[model samples]
Target: MFVRIVKMSFHQDKIPVFLEHFHSVKEQIRNYPGNNFLEVYQDKSNPGIIFTYSVWNDETDLENYRHSDLFKEVWTFTKTLFNDKPEAWSVDKLVTLG
Candidate 1:
């Protein structure tokens, strides 16, 4: 499995807009092929900082999603609300416990 995490810092005032956009597109993302999970989180200490945590079948699946038109549309709108450049990570699972 592949794990993807994206850290986004938003202009404080633009958070609402970002949330609205996220809600609108989140389902599509979660349902996309090869996606096992998707979630959005806000930092407790810094509300303006948000994170997207997702699980994909593999790196190729993640890359395909990134190249999809849906991603382009979402990212184009999302970048405008950022206070800083976003950071992303795609990693293979080392271990898991349930």
Candidate 2:
């Protein structure tokens, strides 16, 4: 599996709106095919910053989701609230220590 991380910074006033939209669609995203896990985090020091961490079976799965209508809808609304350009990374798991 591979991990995907997206960091987004939103306008201060848009944080709550973004979170409301996220809560409404998070379940659908988590249940999408090839998705193994999904979680969201807000920076403790910066409430306007958010990060989405997800695991997928492979790149193809991730790409499919990115191209889906669900993503299109989510992104369209999400982009409008951004205070800065989003950053994303897809990386292979190196190791996990308990």
**Top model by TM-score, which number?**
2
Model 2 has an lDDT value of 0.96
TM-score of each: 0.96, 0.96
Which parts of model 1 have CA positions greater than 4 angstroms off? none
Off by over 4 Å in 2: none
Error of 2 at 92 (Å): 0.7
Worst 10 residues of 1 by lDDT: 84-93
State how far residue 80 of model 2 sits from its true place (Å). Answer: 0.3
> Candidate 1, residues 1-98: lDDT per residue as tens digits?
99999999999999999999999999999998899999899999999999999999998888999999999999999999999989998888899999
Worst-scoring 10-residue span by lDDT in model 2: 88-97
C-alpha lDDT of all candidate models, in order? 0.95, 0.96
At residue 29, candidate 1 shows an lDDT of 94
